[model samples]
Target chain A: MISKVLVRLKEDVLDPAGRALTEQLNHLGFNEVKSAMVGKYIELNMDTGDREKQKERVQEMCHRLLANSLIEDYEIIHEVIEKKP
Target chain B: MISKVLVRLKEDVLDPAGRALTEQLNHLGFNEVKSAMVGKYIELNMDTGDREKQKERVQEMCHRLLANSLIEDYEIIHEVIEKKP
Candidate 1:
């Protein structure tokens, strides 16, 4: 099983890096860009095949190490790969 | 208009950061985690509402700034938000 996690700052949190990117984009002539928010995308390959177990474990991973609950929010997407015979 | 860009290193490219993350996860008792890959997720808010133009501009942004063609690949997802009266 594979899990892809997207961890981003909360709406209320200030993102200086994002602001910098937005400004750089404008300077580069991408004037249509109003703003930019940068985040982390993590892909995990897990040994577990059980969907429920995978979800629970991934959620635990996020809560423990992947994201800071005080200012960041995360979403997990799971993908199951079939083993070839 | 909004565009979400996911930038990741190509499979052929080695990712030491991802390997270190996987090791850390294992050390932290996430024993089910076999491997990990880290990437960037960027959200862009654009002033233009035209979907086609938005796509083209975003692709240009990715090519020119967001992604490194030599080692990284990027995918863009666009969303259109209706303005409230």
Candidate 2:
């Protein structure tokens, strides 16, 4: 089973890397760019069980290892690419 | 209009951040984690057009701003939540 996790900061938090990128982008003449934020994508392949249980395991993984729940929020979605429809 | 961009390192590229996280997870006793990689997701709300054109603009944005095309591969997908089905 393959699960994809997307994690990002809550909107109210300030993003230093994003601010730095905005500064650099303005210097690069991408002057019209309005917003910039940074985050992460994590993919996990596991030897797992039924779909619902797989999802639960992925969520637990996110809560335990994939994200800092205090500042970052994460979502897990899965795809079964190898199996036929 | 809204577009979601997911960007990640090409399969052969080494991810230093991910390696660091793996070490940390190991220390935290997540002994079963076999692999870890880090990437990004960017959501943009724009004033746009037909879904295809909107997607084109998003792809251009990913190429020009959201991703470092040299080392990353990115995909842009759009959702029109404003006009519900």
Candidate 3:
């Protein structure tokens, strides 16, 4: 199975990284660019027959350490792959 | 328009952060997890009536600054939003 987590700062939170990118974009003549945001993309490969259990475990990982729940939001996407013995 | 760029380390490169995450996952009891990868997700908002031009500009941005072409790969996703004006 493959799981992907995308974590981004909350709208209210200040993102200096994002701001820096936006400025760089402007400097590069992308004047139409309005805003930019920088975030984390994590990909995990795991083996588990129980889909529900895998989802729960991934969520726990995100909340416990992968992301700061107070200042960021995360979305998880997963795909299950079957292996032949 | 909104553009999302996902930049990830090449398979051959060593990712200490991903390794650390994998270890943490194991400690947290997700033993089935085989590997984990950490990457960057960047979002940009721009206005360009010319889709082709916008795409080119975004690609340029990725190659020039958003991603390290030598050690990373990037994929861009975009959406165009119409304004009521």
Candidate 4:
């Protein structure tokens, strides 16, 4: 199985990193740009037959270590991919 | 317009972060797992009609700031999706 996450700042928050990138883009001569954001994606492959239970565990992992839930939100995806038999 | 980048450890390299994540998953009772990888993704929204020039600038931005080309790799994409008028 494979699991992936997309983590990003809340829409109402100010993202300094995102703003800096936009400014750099303008400086690089892409003034037609408006705004930008910086985020993270985590990909992992494992063997799983029970996605329901596995997803629950992964969500706990995200809450404890993989993400700072106070500032960022995440989406989880679990799929049966890449059979290693 | 938007640009995104995906950064991950090279396939041949060892990732302690990834290893740790797997161990934690197993410890948390997710024994049906094999391996894991941790990576980053950056996303931005900007206004643009000239995707060619915009993509060029975004690529440069990634090289100089958004990504460290020495170890990380990136991809560039451009599209005319919205009109601010």
Candidate 5:
């Protein structure tokens, strides 16, 4: 199974990196860009085939190691990848 | 318009940060995790309503600033966000 985790800052949190990118984009002539936010995309390849187990493990991973619960939110999606014969 | 851009390193490239995270996950008891890869997720809010122009601008942003064409690949998705009444 392949699990994708997207971790992003909460709506109320200030993202300085995102703010800088927005300014830079404007300076580079992308005046239509109103704002920007940067987040983390993590892909994990797991050896398990059980969907329920994969989801559980991924959620645990996010809670313990991937995201900061105080200011960040994470979403997880799972996909089953077939092995190449 | 809202544009989501995902930028990830080419599979041929080595990702030490991802490797370290994989190892950490294993140490933290996620032994089923075979490997991990880390990528960037950027969200941009644009003032335009034209999907084609938004896509073009996002592609330009990726090429000129968001992603390194030599070592990374980017995927873009556009969504129309409704304003509050």
Candidate 6:
């Protein structure tokens, strides 16, 4: 199974890195770039075949290690990429 | 329009950050985590409503500023989130 986790700062929170990039992009002539928000993308491959179990595990991973739930929000995109053979 | 760019280290390139995170997760008892890869997710909001033009502009942004095309691979997920209003 393959799970993708996207972690990003809440809308109310400020992101300096994203702001800096947006300014740089504007300076570089990407004037159409209205806004840029940066976030983390994590891909995890696991040996499990059960989809429910995979989701549960990924949720735990996100809550425990992957994201700071206080300031960041996470979305888990789960897919069963392979079938055990 | 919203364009999401996911930037990831090339497979041949070593990712120490990803390795460190993997180790930490393992230490935290996520033994089911076969592998973990870390990447960047960037969301860009533009004023245009034309999808093709949006894609072209985003491609340029990726090539010139958003990604190190040599060592990082980028995938652009474009979506027309709202009609210009």
TM-score of each: 0.92, 0.77, 0.88, 0.70, 0.94, 0.92
Candidate 4, residue B27: CA error in Å? Answer: 3.1
Question: What TM-score would you report for chain A in candidate 5?
Answer: 0.92
- Expressed as tens digits, the lDDT of each residue in B1-85 for candidate 6 is 8898889888898988888888888899888888888999898988876889989999999999888989999999887775578
DockQ of 5: 0.87
Number of backbone clashes in candidate 1: 0
lDDT of 4 by residue, A1-85 (tens): 6887768887877899889877877787767668877777787675656788678777877887678888898878676775478
Superposed by TM-score, candidate 4 places the C-alpha of residue A84 at a distance from the truth, in angstroms, of: 8.9
Candidate 6: pairs in clash: none
For candidate 5, write residues A11-61 as lDDT tens digits.
Answer: 899999999999999999999999999999899999987999889989999
Pairwise lDDT winner, candidates 4 and 6: 6
True contacts kept of each: 0.95, 0.41, 0.89, 0.79, 0.95, 0.90
lDDT tens digits, residues B3-83, model 4? 656666676678788789889877876676588787776776756556786677777677677777766666564545665
Which lDDT tens digits does candidate 1 get at residues B1-85?
Answer: 8899989889889999899999999999999999999999999999986889889999999999999999998888888787899
Per-residue error for B58 in candidate 3, Å, reads 1.4
- CAPRI-style class, candidate 1: high
lDDT of predicted model 5: 0.93
In model 2, the Cα lDDT at residue B52 comes to 80
- Classify candidate 4 by CAPRI docking class: medium
| TM-score of candidate 4 versus the correct structure, residues matched by position | 0.70
Candidate 4 Cα misplacement greater than 4 A, ranges: A50-57, A77-85, B50-60, B75-85
Q: Can you rank all candidates by TM-score, best first?
A: 5, 1, 6, 3, 2, 4
Using TM-score, give the best candidate's number.
5
lDDT of each: 0.93, 0.73, 0.90, 0.73, 0.93, 0.88
TM-score of candidate 2 to 2 decimals: 0.77
Comparison by DockQ, 2 against 3, better one: 3
lDDT of 3: 0.90
lDDT per residue (tens digit) for residues B1-85 in model 5:
8998888898999999899999999999999999999999899999987889889989999999999999999889788878789
* TM-score: the better of candidates 4 and 6: 6
Worst window of 10 by summed lDDT in candidate 2 chain A: A28-37
How well is each residue in A1-85 modelled by candidate 6, as lDDT tens digits? Answer: 8898889888889999889988998999888888889999998878786889989988999999899998999988887665569
